[model samples]
Target: MKGQDYYIPAAAMAIALVFKLPALRNNWRDPLLRSVCVLLTLAGAVFTFAAPPTIDAVNEWTGIPNFSAPLVYCLMTAFSASCLVLMFNWRGGPAEEIRATSRRWISGYATVVVAIMVLFALGDAPEQRLRDFDTFYANTPYIRVMIAAYLLAHNVAAMTMVAMCWRWSLQVRGWLRGGLVIIVAGYAFSLTYDATKMSAVVARWLGHNLDDLSTYVAPPLASAGALISAVGFVLPLVCQRTSDSWQTWSTYRRLGTLWHEVQSTAPAGTPGVRMSWWSPAEIRVIQRESDIHDGFLRLGPCFDRRHRDAAYEEALAHGADEETARAVADAAMVAAAVRTSAADPEGTAAEDPGEGERVLIMADGPRDLVRISHALRHSPVVAATRRRATTADG
Candidate 1:
């Protein structure tokens, strides 16, 4: 493979390792996270060791020509085994069930590793073959069998990961689903790597040469698969935080107008004089909601139940759905509250759940608040109510 080809997986592996370091350090007890970290580290090593320059250097340092060939292949086999083990962990079941299944896969791949070593010992390959290793050793004694065994092991692992990822993704959603699909796509490229290498080996057996396919086609496929698989494993954890930040920021932005309108009437409701520029979006949303409710409480003396009822019926008459009408009514009430607070900021009256008003239990949570915020932005009924309140005050 070209130097550039090796650089891609190397870069990907480095990024994955850096991204996962914090999780690995803090959550070492998590089996799945540990497995993913090991998988990425091994994948990077495989890419680095498989590069032609590294192979040549290792051969010269060890004073054994072609020694790095089997060493690199062995590392590749270990990388594949780690990948399957990671996948098994990801498809979680009961602890005992997973342990038993994982042990079996470990034993099976262990046997493959031993067989590869034995075959390499008995084989005769004096030349250092980098890109065309499969075809170069196709007719060599036990080396031929060893090459085939390694390829077989790789293909099996790749296929198993592809199938498992596909099935697992179907059962999940959001970032996890997208991550698994990307993993499946990676292994699909692995299948291509296996196909091209095997075809070249078969061609050698038939006394013909397809060295170009193994040399030119297979390494790129392997490199791409490793990079993608590593990314797939990391995507969910990274994306979860990213998606949350986006949603939180969106909520903070969307509620800005409503928060500003209410806070103007109840300056005392604001708990702080200075807002932190880098405060989390969730914190900002909670603070804003608190200010809104505090302002609403201050307007209790001016809250006219009849006005809210009229707004609700008007929203319904305008063909708003039940939920929409309720939201519009809530927005109108808040708008009126803002006006009332402005008219008499010092009015002292216990906040009453107006007649026909839904007594929103604490369990109702943020749904009602969100609905009212949405209506404040787009509900025509809220605008009409504000106009009526203004005219009445005048």
Candidate 2:
């Protein structure tokens, strides 16, 4: 792969990591968050160090030939371990079990990373091979073992990821399942990467040169696999958050009709709860609902059960379902109460409560409030009732 291929993914992972930093800071002890951060960090490091330009620069800077080879191998090994640890945390078993499993994986990969460094230190590779280190050193003593060890570690991680994600994907649904399926595909690419790299190395040991496979084919495959897996990890989180925000905003909008109607009849100079413009959607929704219920309490004296009963019958006659009819009835009564409250600001025209007449607002929750709001905006029966009330008032 070209330098841009490596650097672009590195930059992308950096951006993703930046986005998660705030949440990570807030919940640093959260196992899943920690795992995600570690995975992104290691993945970015792997890509950044694996780029040909960066490899040459590191070798030149350190004055150690092919120093980047072991460094990149160590980072990739750590990245693989991070992926497994993330999966363990994400799958969510008992906390202690997940911690133990993650620790073991980390320890094993740490050993491999150390072994790669030791082998590289012992091996003599005065000639620098930035892009084809594995192929160039395939016949060297300790370097050969170092190359094989890293590849075997990477291959095992990829196969394990594919199997785990595939099995888990089948057991889940929605965005999580979709993400797992993509993860499986990503790891499948990773396995192909290992296969090509290993193939070239093995061919070298047999005195044949398939150097192009490791030098060219394998880099692109590795880059593609990492980028795809990053997307798989991020897709569910981004999409789920977006979906939740949309739902909250939608609820806030749906409640607007009823909220406005009630607010219009609120007594002049009554104390009101004010929220900041930048409040979260959920907070805004709760505030609006609270204002609506407060309006209902203020308009309680103006409620006439007869208006609701008549509108309910009219709605049923017009073929509204029972639930819709109930919504329409509640909407009609709210509309009439708004008119009555407007005419009698002192509430002098309020009727005494009839025994067994339940207060409509108190009888239902937020969902019913949304249904009534929708009915208030669209129900023909409620519209007719509002027209009649306006006429009677005029």
Candidate 3:
């Protein structure tokens, strides 16, 4: 392939690696994260070293004809091993079992890499064939063995990944399943790459020439497959994180209505705890909820069960569902309490619930808080009750 084709993918992988580095540094013991980083590193190296311009440069710089051949082959072998190790870690089983399996794959591929280098050193390739080295030396003793060895290793890894990901996809759902399916498709392309390269090599062994398949057809397939596989590996992680962030921010926004209403009634100089601008959405939400509950506590003496009961009956009479009616009633009570607390800042005139009346404002969690916020913003019963409380206070 051309320099741009190879370098572009290399650059992309480098960017992906950079994004993962912080997480990897913090959780270096995490095998899955390590596997991902290693896979990206090896994949990028394979593309960079296999480019025709890079191959020619390495040969010239090293003063050895076709020295780039074994270098690229060993890189490809390690890349294949990284893919298998990543899949094993990603599938997840007993921790020990995962570790053992990954180690075995790494050891085996390391052996393959050593063997490729040994074969290349023993074989004589006096003529440098930058792009067509595999097919050009397909019948030259140890060179032929090296070519078959790398292709076989690559094919085995591709087939194994396709099978594993396909089976695992069936057992999962959502984005994970989609990612696995895409990974399977990517490895399918990898298999096609192996097929084309092997076809050219085998044809050369049989006194025929199909060098075009190896020289022209296989590199693109390899590049496309690697790119697709990288996307598949990344899709589920990026999408899930995005989904979580969106939900947290939505919660923070929805709670704004209730927080604002209660905050206005808090004592002067006690404006609740203010969060820094750089806080995460989750931390911001926690702070808002804390402030809201503090407001509810300050307004507790102002709560009157009678106001809630009247609003609840009004909401039910107007065809609201039970859950919504409860929310409306609670919102009405809170709205009236805000005005009562304002009218009697000393809280001496505040009335408690009767013997059997239950206080629900502080009983539940964030879900109830969101419902009350919705009711405060939208319920007519809550609005009317607030108006009546204002009139009475005046």
Candidate 4:
């Protein structure tokens, strides 16, 4: 039975471990700490599993029995208590005061837990033993206090953790915010069941009745808690991966829509017809390139930042000096800006391409052609610009 109680926590621990690895971030949001606590809870489960069966069958309390139940559960309590301590500590950032305070809190809790465990051990006496067959109970005074203190300590700690997570959810996000709460709630449920069982056992002993309510109440709650905590731990991993995928897809979709719009705007064979005006070239140009001129062609018009960077890198790598690279980069920027700006005012006299005395912004030069590769790599404007310049020059 105790084995069953610890198993859920064990499962929670295992799930939390996935977040602990260094490949993942070690922030408070991370589940590594939670995982450690669950594992410790699992350790508690082990002792409960081992001792409960023997106690349950002992109908008479007269034997000089080993009082390992509370002692072992105390160990579990320490693990659970330690978990709450860490969760509380996360509220403190880099400030020394917060850190010192958290440390002090942990130290105090630790002392209390150790002292309580020892008290339970020391307080047990042969005369105080409930030695009647067909009856089970804690008929001793100190035993009662030790159990109450331990449970009370755990309850206080677990609920505080839940409240902390709840408070953080006001501004927090992802798994840390949600998972912390779920884990806290689960532990809370399990602990409450435990405390309630302790209360019931006391009542049953006083009345000389043997009703194992703790056994009945605990396992199911622990299982439910295990499931909740497991979800809490794994949900963040799923959310993150999904978010990245959504962002990537959104970017590609935007780029695709832009490509279609540019294609439709170009006039047939006009190079950069209305649709193609802002687009890049399709055919790559092969002119004098630098030392590694054989690199991939990324044709772009005189615009497009990414395309321009690629062109700039290519130009420098292919042996073009800094002066040449700067000139090409600057010239492309000016042309792209000019084209975009010119298109803004429809019906304005300044936009008429055939108007006399206009330079026509010829993109036929060798410098322009080299940079076109960069534009083509980034946007559709490169191909359109190339076709326009080729037609105009011819």
Candidate 5:
């Protein structure tokens, strides 16, 4: 169970590291990102050391008797410290407060690490006890206290995170709230891990074997908790980025019909090579918006205010709201302009005073442009106005 349990956290740790690598590299100064990276690295190291197969390999290569034991214990202590620091950094309070909190956690955990090393140094385990190190060393003089100390530290960190998350969860919402809840659940399992292992150790001291609790029961709980905690940390960032990309892509696709219609009237406004299907949503949206503005600029002289006014009245008659009617009126003028520009590019001129030089609709942003595009594509008033202008010219 110990060896098999390692793989679950190992995979999760790898995924977390990969996901945060860009943030880690690009924004190394970001405290939250840095803390998360450190936490994940320590977690991976703990899992790597916990596995008997990995411990044996390192022991054989290093030729240090029971070296993996101290290494694993130290790594676990560091993992606990990193986890707490990550929580503090994640739940930002104030700059000075964060620094003070971080400094205190570091100083306290450093003392715990030193104590674990000293206890390992005092213990005499000539042979390796890979599978049942805690049970085998349960009665060994200073080693017993050392194991107890490490478990104490582990339990303290677990309880602290659980309490912190539970309290903080009440103040947050959406992904952060949900994440805190999952983290609390994971830490609940962590507390179970501590209780079960401590029970096994105490049982060994009492001249009985509850080794199965440590060997069979606690490892899976620890593994499950670690995996869930990692996911809880990463879920918000991953889900948000995914949602933003989906929205950008949706907006890009929805604007396509309107962009095509305007682009036909002003072919130069079409971004032929740059507007490929392979282009990123952000780039395509920018280019599409730019081209729509350019196409409207070219159609300015052809805009007829009377035609726009008629379209607005017709839109109101069709039960369109004020905003929708305005958008329909603008789209109708653009459609009529496209026909006028197509007929006589040189001869086309607006007869209305001071209206010929003004830009059509202005575009403004994606929302305004999208609304106009929607009216151009689907509004019956825009189509009717376009047909009336075409007939008048004929």
Candidate 6:
């Protein structure tokens, strides 16, 4: 019988419409994202129990009186609009693109939702509740058959959702993608759950009704969990970006350090400025400064003074006595100068996550690196050594 089925479908309805909302349509980075996701969860929950019809009949597990059409639609609808508002208002997409791809997701899901609700609402016509999965599945094929179409279609859609998630898993970095891959695997496993039920003979062999274990209830629970887990894919991306944004200063410091490092590296031909040229003592200091101020600049300039002081203290500790301390202090100053320069493209400090000092020679013509080598050959130290060796030979 058509019952509380509409609530789940209705939620899908609200989210689909939200996809088209002006606010969420354009903005992706808005801060209210978690709230929106929570609403989605609520909507999913409402859909679950609501779709099952209420019956005065005793449930196998609860032995409690069950009521048909679970009153989910009416009760959940009361909050659906508000939930939609919350969802549509949160942010996660480029302004040019819809903030969340979930908007489109809801829209597609809504087709089934609307059909399920409409069927449930219509099936209850004559102002009476009709209770039977058989009637709903088979008899309705005579009417608009919208519900039937949606049910089978949902299977396909579920498969498609898993496929999309699978494809996305290939593109992103980190374990987030792998986590999503697991989620998609769950959906895949779920799709096969119904069809692979134990045969009646097998059920007898196993001392259980396959239907008892293979009830309609379990899949939805698992599916919902899978959907929620799939949502984690978005979280890491959000947090990592936020954390990175917060570290702009540290990133700047890193780049600044790299510049000084490059300077200290000196040209390769002339005992060059690379870390390789520095005594082990010097490289240790540069690396230490790089580690300390890693992402500090992203928070903007109005930061606490204590951080700067902390950095100074850190430098001193690493300096490890007079000469090294002097060297460390010089390294820190060079990095600080880079932080102030704002010469980095778009004020981003270093392009790489870990920046080091090195001279990159870009040449349009013949080997330019060799020219520096030739110049190094004629330097005072080399020339004087050559003369001394020649006098000894003579």
Best by lDDT: 3
- Residue 51 of model 1 has an lDDT of 87
The candidate with the higher TM-score, 1 or 2, is 2
User: CA lDDT of 349 in candidate 3?
Assistant: 67
Alpha-carbon runs more than 4 Å astray in model 1: 20-36, 88-107, 114-126, 135-145, 167-182, 202-213, 228-241, 265-270, 273-278, 290-304, 349-363, 390-394
Tens-digit lDDT track of model 2 for 180-234: 9899889888999999999999999999999999988988889889889978988
The global Cα lDDT (0 to 1) of model 4 is: 0.48
Q: Which pairs clash in model 1?
A: none
Minimum summed lDDT over a 10-residue window in model 2 is located at: 351-360
> Candidates' TM-scores?
0.79, 0.91, 0.90, 0.52, 0.85, 0.39
Which clashing pairs does model 5 show? none
Ranking of all candidate structures by their TM-score, best first? 2, 3, 5, 1, 4, 6
TM-score (C-alpha) between model 3 and the true structure:
0.90
**Model 5 stretches astray by more than 4 angstroms:** 19-23, 26-29, 92-100, 204-209, 267-279, 304-313, 321-323, 351-364
Model 6, CA-based lDDT: 0.40
Return model 2's CA RMSD, one decimal: 2.4
How should the candidates be ordered by lDDT, best one leading?
Answer: 3, 2, 5, 1, 4, 6
Q: Each prediction's Cα lDDT score?
A: 0.79, 0.89, 0.90, 0.48, 0.83, 0.40
Query: What is candidate 1's CA lDDT for residue 306?
Result: 64
> Candidate 6, 75: how far from true, in Å?
12
Per-residue lDDT value at 190 in model 3 = 94
Across residues 186-289, which tens digit of lDDT does each residue of candidate 1 receive? 99999999999999999999999999889899888988888888788878867887898888788777777667776777565555545699777788878877
TM-score (C-alpha, index-matched) for candidate 6: 0.39
Per-residue lDDT of candidate 6, residues 235-337 (tens digit): 5545655565555434333344333433432323543234554344434444534433332233122122232333345545644444333333333333333
For residues 1-394, write the lDDT of model 3, one tens digit per residue: 6899999999999999999899899999998889889988988898899888999999999999999999999998999999899889888899999989989999999999999999999998999998899988999999999999999999999999999999899999999999999999999899999999999999999999999999999999999999889888878877877898998899889999999999999768874566788889989988889888988888777888889999999999999999999999999999998998888888766653342243548537778899999999999999999999999877
